[model samples]
Target: MTLALVEPTVDLYGAWWEAHEEWGPGLHEDGFGLAAGDEVDSPAGFTAWVERVKAEDSTCRWIVEDGQVQGGIALRHQLNEATGHIGYGVRPSARGRGLATWALGEMLNEARALGIGRVLLVCVADNEGSLRTIERNGGVLEGIRGDARRYWIELPAAGESGVLTEKGADG
Candidate 1:
């Protein structure tokens, strides 16, 4: 299947909402940058949210496959100890196709383009899919804090090989 990471736009509203509804009611969708007060159900509110998340500090992209919204991924320009520098998620119906892995690899490329040498990614310890996705992209286990598993991924510099290794997987 062909997958494209594109900017969030109103044109995909229906498709996005279908994926959003499948995820049900929760802020855990990740990468869409949903806020507590934002009303994504309405056109005006979604429009506002789209504008807000596209700010200079962050980059958000929707994962579109075969003209449908499958998931989303975001790269934060500034690193936060709690949330890390990148976040992403694939819709429930679209799982198991390696979409998250592909999106993450693309986001890592974006991070490298921005001069970020390394990034921290955290996921629940029980989330095997997310854990594997991160690891496939070179994420090294830093430690487990409570229910969160923190990892650090070091990006290869320009002209270096992009192949990810399991060098620090035991960490």
Candidate 2:
């Protein structure tokens, strides 16, 4: 499996749409808020949200396996004066193959380089796979949100680690 992060482009709109349409409803009540598309309602909202995330710093997608965009994860920077962190996620079907674990590790590797101190991730209460993925990535369960479980993974205070470099872009 090859894994690499890239920016969103028009070319991705189609696959993103298909992935979002299929996973949206089952993933959250705010289906429109979560899916990726061009409509001002569902996918548009995601685009706008992603843009905001970019403004804070940078955004990226984690593509895994055979150069296919099977799933993606974004590292959204938090600008709150009190806390500096990154947020991320992966596609639904890509859940079982340890992609999330790999993606989260890569995100944190990037975060550490970007001077981000903490990484936060949340999963729906029933998303057992996600919970396991997060735990595998060294996430510490913080608490529960309305219907989600929150976690925090602290990046090493300093020093470069061989974590992200081990996996080439072809995973």
Candidate 3:
């Protein structure tokens, strides 16, 4: 299956909604940049949200496979103490396929391109999948704050090799 990270576009509205619905109702979709007041249920609202995230201080990309939205990943240009510098999520159906790991690795390159020397990623303590994904991308456990486990990854300089060279299912 060919996978790609692409900018959010209205053309993928239906595909995005399919993945969004699988996530259920909430603003908990990491990397989606969904706000409490944003209305993504309507065409205009969705378009506006797309524009907002694209114009924001972050980079958002939808994970697409075979022309369907499988998940999302975002690299925050600014370092957020609470949320960290990167966030991502895969649709429930898309889990276990290493999509998150692949996307995170890709975003790490983006972070490096932005001249970020290091990045932080936080995931729930009990989220084994997330833990593995982060670890696979060279995340070093910093500590646990409350229920969240914080990790820091030192990015390689531009042109250096990355941790992941090809996509595969989560091992």
Candidate 4:
């Protein structure tokens, strides 16, 4: 089904949200519904959210396993210094499977494909798992924001460092 239909249809995004709502709105962020219809109720509200969020060079996707949502990833284009803001989360049941790490890699490839040269990924310091995942992906420590730690993952470019070579080589 098309993405537009998913949010408004109970059969598609509804079931996924029912199962994973505990992840919080901050997880799926969807690039849409950030301001309008944060609670995704009415079909009209969902449609409005979609229309208002048609920003250029940005995207979000859910990771599915056995037809169920396991995680989600998103990139906010040029959130800062020409770097995309990368964010992701794996469902509670999907934890410990390295799915977040894998998902981040996929999002990185998506960013590179869009000509993104770097991404800033921030997570809570208490999230040891996330810190590990970012480090494994060549994310360099940037700074700390309250309880969050910021990292910059460099993608391969004509003159930039090849920190993301692992994926860029094949991406």
Which regions of candidate 3 are displaced past 4 Å?
159-171
Tens digit per residue, CA lDDT, model 3, 1-171: 999999999999999999999999998889888889999999999999899999999999999999999998999999999989999999999999899999998999899989999999999999999999999999989999999999999887877765544446544
Cα-lDDT of candidate 2: 0.60
Candidate 4 stretches greater than 4 Å from native: 1-11, 24-36, 42-57, 80-84, 158-171
Ordering by TM-score: 1, 3, 4, 2
Error of 1 at 29 (Å): 0.6
Every model: Cα RMSD to truth: 3.3, 8.3, 6.3, 6.4
Q: In order, what lDDT does every prediction score?
A: 0.91, 0.60, 0.92, 0.64
Each prediction's TM-score versus the true structure: 0.92, 0.65, 0.92, 0.70
Model 4: which ten-residue window has the lowest total lDDT? Answer: 1-10
Model 1 per-residue lDDT tens digits across residues 1-171: 778999999888999999999999989888888989889999998888888888648889999999899999989989988889999999998999999999999999999999999999988899999999999888989999999999999988999986765779747
**Candidate 3 lDDT score at position 51:** 95
Clashes of 3: 0
Higher-lDDT candidate of 1 and 2: 1
Q: Pick the candidate with the highest TM-score.
A: 1
- Candidate no. 3 TM-score: 0.92
Model 4 residue 160 lDDT score:
56
Write one digit per residue (lDDT tens) for candidate 4, span 73-155. Answer: 66776675322387666667767887778778877887888888878888877989889989988899998877878898888
